[model samples]
Target: MNRISIIIPMLNEADHIDNLLTHLLENSSKENIADIIIVDGGSTDGSLDIVSKYKSISFFSSPKGRAKQMNLGAKYATGNILYFLHADSFPPKNFDTLIITEVKKGHEAGCFIMKFNSNHWWLKLAGQLTRLSWQACRGGDQSQFITTSLFNNIGRFNEDFTIYEDNDLIARLYDRKQFVVIQKWLTTSARCYYTNGVWKLQYYYWRIHLKKWMGADAKELNRYYKKYVC
Candidate 1:
């Protein structure tokens, strides 16, 4: 039987963690889930206290990086499939069954098409673009699901990247032609766009993607991110 282990890497997400946990359990069948692992990257906002209240979830502390945190959680996961989610993203109803259905259909890996929880015109346009098969439209907020064996075979999420780790993994999956886009909507928080202004944040993201394509290393990418996004 294929069971999915949901892995979430978060830092200082105290505002959303509890609600996200509740939403996840309510949307999917517990029988289809092997475990829900939450890996924290040194949170100081009492996120740990909030997470500990959920007995079904397995929580651990790790060095402050999403890639590293995800890898650690994955190492302890016993499920045949792994679902990597963002703390502020919510998948569609019966999301586990949706993923398992795709897997059973011979699709090795995929993510739900995503929308931002906002009404901004630009963001709406961005969400619409995600429906395309082009990899340029992809981002981490889509919530990736992959078979554990295939995940390991791809060398897992690249720990060397402080950013663009998701893109890196997705790019590799695209290279192998092992990727798909489920025709469902996942809603992700647009808090970053709100905090940084929509246009500014979007521009920064585009620049980062361009830099990565132009042969920038992880350290260089980190520098650009720290300079602008952070």
Candidate 2:
């Protein structure tokens, strides 16, 4: 009977927030959801107004960084499990039941494999690879869920990271062998890739992952992302 708190960190995401929230409400039972919390990073795109109108959801403000916003939402969550999701990603139907089922089975941390909303062959292949439990295939777009106790134990997402925070947290989970990959798929927006060009965007993304693995500092990593991806 553990409830889930869906925490989303967003900035200028008005274009996607309403539909995403509606999908979540329609697909999951209110009884299984303690609350949906939207932690805004000073959004100026009317995203705040949209979230505020949602029933049974809480709204909070935070400094403009993904990690900081998510951590802030975690602090205010009341559910036993915290589900961190992207504003542009949509989980499968009955995802709440799936998460509760896995948690009851003792899988404390995990995420659904994700497919980009693109028909491109490379994107399809990338999505397929996420079905494997290998660490290399994981990313924030897939969305993450972890027991509140375990999240507290691990000290939560590193605020030092302006980006790549999800991978950083997943690396720790992997180190402790405390992660799993649910077979279901979350559909994430491919807007970034489309806007930046699929091949070019992916190259920079892969490079960032490599740099992080090679011990690049958070500042250095963010610099590269801003220069290349943003």
Candidate 3:
């Protein structure tokens, strides 16, 4: 029987951790989940305390980088399927069944289409665009599900990336034509866009995509992100 190990690499996500966990339990079958792993990267906002409330969750600490954190989680996971999710993204109801169905059908890697929790027009448009099967529409906020063997074979996520780690791995999957976009919607928080201004954040995101496409290294991308992610 296939099982899923859900890995959530988070930093200072106190507001969403509890709710996300509860939602996961309410929506997924206990038998389908091998375990829920919470890899914290030095969160100071009592996220650890929130996580500790759930004795069933496998919680641990890691250095402050998502790639490093997720890779570590993958190492400890016993499940045949690895589901990497963001701190504030909530997958659709019975998401586990959906993933297992896809895997049985031979989709070794994929993510559900995503939408921001916000109702801003541009955000709405962006959500609509995600319905397409284009690689550009794919992102970490949608969450990722891959078979453990395939994930290991692909070298997992690149630890060198302080950011764009998700995109980097996703691009390779697309190249191999091994990526799928499930029709369900995964809702993600747009708090960053709210705080940073949607247009500004979106512009910088596009610029980073352009830079990455131009062959900029991870270091350059991180520097550029830090310079404007305010």
lDDT string, candidate 2, 6-71, tens digits? 999989999999999999999999899998999988899889888889767899989999999999
Better of 2 and 3 by TM-score: 3
| Superposed model 3: Cα runs more than 4 Å off | none
TM-score of each: 0.99, 0.98, 0.99
| Residue range 1-230, candidate 1, lDDT tens digits | 98999999989999999989999999999889999999999999999999999998999889999999999999999999999999999999999999999999999899999999999999999999999999998988999999999999999999889999999999999999999999999999999999999999989998999899899999999999989888
Report, for all candidates in order, the number of backbone clashes.
0, 0, 0
Worst 10 residues of 3 by lDDT: 221-230
Q: Give the higher-lDDT candidate: 2 or 3.
A: 3
By TM-score rank, best first, the candidates go 3, 1, 2
For residue 132, what is the lDDT in candidate 3? 95
TM-score of 1: 0.99
